[model samples]
Target chain A: MSGYWAGILSILAINIIFAYGIFIPVASGQLNLGGAGFQAVGAYSAGWLSASFGLPVSVTIAFGVIVTGVIGVLIAFPILRTKGVYLVLATFAFAEVIAGAILSSEPLGGAMGISVPGYIDWYVSVIFAGLVTVFVFYLMATRFGLTIRAIHDDEDVSDLMGVSVRNVKVAAFGIGAALTGLSGGLYAHSFSYIEIQGFNALVSIYVLLYVLLGGTQTAWGPLVGATFFTLLPEALRSVLPATKNFLVTLFGETGIVAPPDESWRFVILGALTVLMMVFRPEGLVTRTMVERLQFWRPANRGVTQ
Target chain B: MLLLQQFVNSIMLGSVYVTVAVAFTLTIGILNFLNFTIPTLFMIAGMMGWALSYYGLPLGLSGPLPWPIALMGAVVLTIIASLIVERFTFRYLKTKYGDSTEHAIPLVSSLGFLLVLENLVRIGYGTDSRRFEGPDADLTMNIGGIFVRVPQLVSLAVTVVIVLGLTMMIKHSRIGRGLRAIAENPDAANILGVDTRRIVPVVFILTGLLCGLAGALFAINYGEVSPAMGEDIGTKAIAGMVIGGLGSIWGAVLGGLIVGLIEMMTVHFFGADTVQVMVWGALLLTLLAYPSGLLGHNTIGKGKL
Candidate 1:
């Protein structure tokens, strides 16, 4: 493949992994807006391990994911204590704390950021993304996934049904953190650099948006959402310029007629978000939609067997 | 003396945070909606103010107006944008499914608006910061060995007045009572003749007004405006709002000031790079220790995810 397509595919793969990392907790009735914090932990850990200790790529990646998972479990107790807007604010703060710590830590290269020695080909990311996707799909098919969905539908009812709400939430959060970490490690290795700036609050917001906009009701949400958003700018990269040219032709002469692709993409994203919430707040790949796609009967939608 | 000066400066900075935090707390309090668009509204006011001042009104309506008119125009535009946000996000809160993540719909849509508005501003103007030629940016006064900018003092006074007025409005007025009822229970309030549709937009109006004023003050005092200006201040305001308690007005005031103090002190002691860590760490600690925040009622955001 050409370098351009390779770059886009790699990014697409990383984003998919990251989105799933967020999807797990969200699916379990918790909003993990701290995805970037966990990802930063994973990326920086990989970078630091490879740079300082001369660790291999596999070791660094594993260590990064493990560390983030542990941290996720540790923080989940406090973070999950709050619900709704409070939960969102807490996670958002967590990401900022992580970014701030990295920015000030000398060992992490501070503001200048760190460069990684371990480099991975684009295919590595794609393979990892596919494995992660399958793993999440498999997870959602299990009894554990049912418990999560149960909690997501109604936490009080899930608790009454003896679903171990706390444990399920923590588990989902930790696993999500690990997956996010894996993506971050891939990002670090693929880009051959890791910076604190890359893990800012916007990254967390965008990842959360991807999962929510895709649909939190089913496993298909993250996949479709991530793929669409990852490819959106590239699609716009072609269409926006043409539209701008058309505008120029119609208007004849205007000041500064360059294509406003950067801004247009976000405007489109925002507009879609608004429209989706209004028309399909359940998201694009909701449970009913997924079941319909699977050709399942309406009564069997929530049944295990 | 220098320390005292820092204190005064911190309070001035806190005033901006106070305004924005009040805006945040109000929406979360009354509407139970975490309106992320507040920051964008803040940015919009400042950037549009800059655009109007620098480039004149669009379509050759008039030459670049005076500073006062530009700022007023900015605030008016922000209110309009906020109403537009209300139309999309809050209007769709009541859904048939009644899922756990239903409440997140408005929150997510606001995030979309954040992206849209910020990027739109970036597209209209360049992403770089623009010099805002407001009323005497360098105008300062020395009070008891501490230096204070005239515009900063004016903003601080204005913020105090507006917040106090808002508090009274929410406490004593019939509309205030209706808002409180909605905060208690939207459906009950609607049934009780609170006019949910009409009163709800009032929250957005107040949010827009507060954010717009803060943005204008920021531009006038700092003599700079940028498309990205809102993210930093907005996040800090969120931290303040959470710290003060989500639904409490006075709590936001104290929280905003406290955040400002923390920010200034962190810059003084730990250097500028660690400010994010300190502020966010404080927020994390607060959420863990006192989830309701310093003055938040336990019932405000206790809804299920």
Candidate 2:
């Protein structure tokens, strides 16, 4: 495949992992926005370890995932203490701190970021994506999943019902972080490079968006959200060359005016988000709702309605 | 002296955050949750004023005055933006999900908005920071070997005056008492005929206007405005609100001032880069230890969301 096709696949692959990375916590009634931070640590750890210690790619990836899982477990302590917006804030802060450290610290390769030789390929990323898809699907149907939903609906009631809210939250966080770390490791190798921007807070937002806009109810919501977003703008660029900058800038930081990629992009985009939430908070392609979660009949067409 | 200057600068930075925390607290308290895209109103208003100025619109071309008048014009524009966020985020979330599931949706949609808003600025203003040299006064002076710039000093005073005035207004004024009633219990306020629907948008517009004003003041104090400035400051504001105690108007104000001062003291005592992030980490620890913060709301420990 050409670099463009390969690039698209890699992007999709990473996003799929990211989508699931967010989905695990969110589905369990916890919204963790520190995916990119965990991902970055995993990526950098794997990158640095492989390069410096001459460890095999698989070993470094495993170690990176384990270490990040431990960090996730640590984070869960405070996260479990707070409810709602506070939890999101804690996770967001954690991610920001990690990103800041990555940017300023010299041993972490400073702002330039260390480059890594190709240790993973499109196949590896695709396989990981499959693993996430299968695992989440399976996990969402289990008894533990019911408890997670219970926690999501109401923490106090769940606790009253004998659910270990703290432990479950921690477990969910560890799982999410592990997936993110693995994805990050793959991402570092896929790009053959890593930088501060790779796991900045914005990436966390993007992953959250992927879960939300895709329709967090079923297995397919995140995948669709990630795939569509990752590709739609890129595909539009190739088909409509003149309007590509306009469309992309219309999405990113700069907006469409004169150069079409001006700073107003976010200002208007923010307004548009308000529009989307008001008009269609459910998402473009929602999950087919099946209250039973069985392999039985799929009732609702989308996740929301 | 350089150390002290950076410390002072951080406090100056904190003033803007104080305003933001106040605005955020005011809005959330009234509505219980926000639509997410609201934060962008701050950036959009300031950027609009900048855009108008860039287009050679006279400072007060909206009327027969100066830049401050234009800034108010921007505030009016942001009031519209707040309504927009309301109609979009709230209208749908309320319609589809009810009040309970509203938490994650707004923030996610806002993330989408943030991207668009920041990018709009980047594309419109060329990704580089825009130099905004507002009218300068020779008010900057040295206090105990610490130089406080005129704008910074003015911003500090303005923030204090605004916070104090608003606090008093909220605590004593008819509307203030009504808002307090509504915030304490929207259902009760509604039963007592508070006209919550009216109050919700009013609160949003009021907070948005404050945010716009703060953003303009921020532009003046910082000498340059960048698209990226809002994220970190916005985070700090959230932290301030969390630390000071959510929904406590006085707490928010005090929290902002404390955060500002701590930041300054840290920078003064330690190196700028080292102290800056350390302050956040320290603040997080303090808040965690205290749980609700200096004067924080009670629900943070509940873990309900």
Candidate 3:
């Protein structure tokens, strides 16, 4: 159960990082779905280095972040040439490559993944999540943030306005990817083991969902979304009858009962995203909250619908 | 000689990509959002087929499907699941909060649905992959030493037929013209008396059926299915869709096949491990350089050179 609590906290921290990672690119109007890919690189880097090289967990994490960050820059250099949806496709492809690489790269444990030292705890996760959120909030307030927002609104105009559209997008990708890598490092440090299976494209989608569910505008959306989303299912699992009354009740009463037994989390999440996009693109929190917190507003408030 | 075998293999995989990408293109074009559930649909089809087979209910016993006798029993089952998502999740959100620029909530909620579906399948069936049975099972036939299997051949034929038929319908059929009109200009299409709302459900049903059919074929072709299948297949399809340039149905088909061939060629030339994915990353970079997608109209942001 304590492990569960730790899992919950780690989920929160990872979600925070995931949300911010997505937000930074999105703030500039790019919907890159490759955070999970960067996280995979970082996770594998930390796991492999710590396992084979006997590096300190902290040093391995740093190495992992730096390595993934560099990879992010390399990828960004080519892909950011496209805008909006094209960027999303590029990142999604990037994540898939990472997943396949992890699955095939045996020295890094391939599909089996690798084990690393455990140095992160609940307190550490909480502190990291908080600090990262605060840092991102501040970063979005500066000139750099304003430019990203401007790009998000209108890339051509922003480019004309002297915003280095390409540079800023690349910066967003690199920074967002760094956060994903950091989360991977923390994940390795907390669990002492890592696998491609764990840090998969699905996790990337989950991170995106948490950020979206929490409302991407508010800096705290990731934290709130991660904490609630991760714990909710586990809690539901515990409450369900052994005979699987839960599925019946969930579908009948709530009309969203996940299929019994196998984790219906993916189906549930995917479906929810469609529904949410159609109905409330803003999430539970209003966009005004994000606008009011201008520093956290990676782009201009007036331009956003 | 080996190259010829790989080409066939590539085409077979490319057909699958075509199916999934077509579904995604329709949704994205109409709804103004990328319903990531497209992947889940692929997964669900596999799970459904797996569950039926696991219960000793072979395709022979199931009768030729489309199982219209029971709406939820056949291909229509996918439509039911999709509608459930649209109604409960998307409808609820749309009712609660109107569409805004923020993508966090909808994306996350839909993601939650995806997770739920995945986990439910996992709970019902174990994480291990399962073999497909009956008419859908693998049957090898050596055609000039290429060794075409039942699943692959059947799927390819079905794909060609479906694509051709659908293309005809879209180009000349009454509903097809409207769908195209809507895709071309939604407001204009609506003003011209195209019932966009009615078309939405029809499109969902059509796309879901494709996924379900293709999914079933994939299981039978490989003789094995896994929960992770969706993520991998979806990633490649996404790359195909982008590289071909989204929107045009033909674009998705061509894109999927090209990507499939590229993946196979890479695998044939490079070690089997790196081939399929390495090209995806590189191709994504290539597509990004174009920004209009391989064939899209133009970059959305007007930052074009």
Candidate 4:
């Protein structure tokens, strides 16, 4: 594959992993706007481990995931105490704190950022993404995932049914954090550089948007959401200028038409998000939709959801 | 004396946060939805104002306009944009799934708008910060050994007046009653003859007005405007809103001021790099220790996700 395709694929892989990282918490009905913070922790951990100790890529990436997972567990106790909008804001604040601490810590290179000593090929990340996708699918099929969905549907009812709401939320949050960290570690190794700026609040917002747009009802949501959005800009790159040229030619305007604005992709994304929420607030996919796709399996339809 | 100067400057800075935070608290309080496009609306006013004054209207429709007129035009544009946001986000919020993320429909849509609007502004105007040509920003007054910028003082006064007026309207006006009814229960409010369709837009209008005014004041006081300016201010305002407690206007005012002071002090004592950590850390702590915030109603946002 060409470098361009490799670059896009690598990014897509990382984003898919990251999107699932967020999808776990969101799937349980928590809006984790602090995704970038957890990601930064993971990235910095790998970057620091490789740079400081000359660690191998696997070791550093593993260390990154473990450390972020531990941090997630520690933070989740207090964070899960809040709900709804407050929960969202708390996560957002947590991410900002992480970014800020990294930015100010001299050992982390402060604002200068850090370059990783370890490097990984795009295929490594792609493989990781595939494994993660399978893992999430397996997870959603389990009893724990059922409880999570139960809690998501109605917390009071879930609690009344004897589900440990706190434990489930915390576990989901920690696991989500770990996955996000893994993605970050891969990102560090793939790019060979890490910067606090890349993990700003907007990153968190974008990831959350991906998951939400995908539909939090099932494991497929993040995959579809992330894939569509990550590739949308590339699709627009080819399509927008042509459409602009077509319009210009059709109008026979004498003035020079500027190339299509790069912002149109996001505008379309925003518009789609709005329309989707209005028309199909369950997201691009639904349990029924998934069931219908498996039309031959009428026996399995009763179990879906 | 130096300390006193920082305090005065902090108050001036806090006024901007106060305005934005109030807008935030208002939406969360009334609609139970965290309106993410608020910052975008704020930016729209500032960037559009700058564009109107520097580059004239879109597509060569007109030459550079006067500063005040430009600001007015910007506010109008923001209000219109806000109404559009309401159409996409608020109007179609009720979802069929009745799942955990149902509450997030509007919030997610708002995030969509946030990306769309902010990027569109970036595409229309370059991403660089530009000096806003307003009435002389240099005008200052000496008060008890501290120098205060006249524009900042005026802006602060304006914020106070607006807040007080808003409080009165919410407390006494028929519209205020309608809004409160909706906040208590949208269905009951509708049953009681409150115009859900009509009054919901009022919240957006108020949100637009507050954000627009804050953006204008920020431009006049700081003498700089950028497409990205709102992100920082908006986040800080969120910190303020949380500190003061969501759904409490007075709390937002106090929270905004306190955050402003904390930010200035962090900058003064710990250097600029630590402000993010300090502010966000404070927010995290608050979310843990006092999830309801300093003055937040215990019942607000306490429901399941």
Top lDDT hit:
4
Most accurate candidate by DockQ: 4
Give the TM-score of each candidate: 0.97, 0.87, 0.81, 0.97
* Candidates sorted on DockQ, descending: 4, 1, 2, 3
Report model 1's TM-score to 2 decimal places.
Answer: 0.97
Q: Which prediction has more favorable TM-score, 2 or 3?
A: 2
Pairwise TM-score winner, candidates 3 and 4: 4
Error of 4 at B35 (Å): 0.7
Off by more than 4 A, model 1: A250-257, A295-305
Between candidates 3 and 4, the one scoring higher on lDDT is: 4
Query: Candidate 3's residue-wise lDDT over B1-305, tens digit each?
Result: 99899998899889999998888766655554466677888888877766654553454675433311222343456767777666554444432322223433434455666777777777767788876554534478988788888768878998889888887988899998888777666679989999877876677777788888778767767767888789778877777777676666677788889889988898778767786467577656666566555555552322210
Query: On residues B13-117, what C-alpha lDDT tens digit does candidate 1 reach at each position?
Result: 999999999999998888788888988899999999999998889999899989999999999998998899898888766667676788788888888888887
**Candidates' lDDT values, in order?**
0.90, 0.72, 0.70, 0.91
Which stretches in model 3 have alpha-carbon errors above 4 Å? Answer: A1-11, A117-122, A153-164, A241-279, A287-305, B29-32, B49-73, B83-110, B125-128, B136-142, B225-227, B266-271, B291-305
Name the better of 1 and 2 by lDDT. 1
Q: Place model 3 in a CAPRI quality band.
A: acceptable
Say which prediction, candidate 1 or candidate 4, comes out ahead on DockQ: 4
Q: Ten consecutive residues with minimal summed lDDT in candidate 2 chain B?
A: B93-102
Q: What is the TM-score of chain B in candidate 2?
A: 0.83
Overlapping backbone residue pairs in candidate 1 total: 0
lDDT of 2 by residue, A17-43 (tens): 878888888877677777888999889
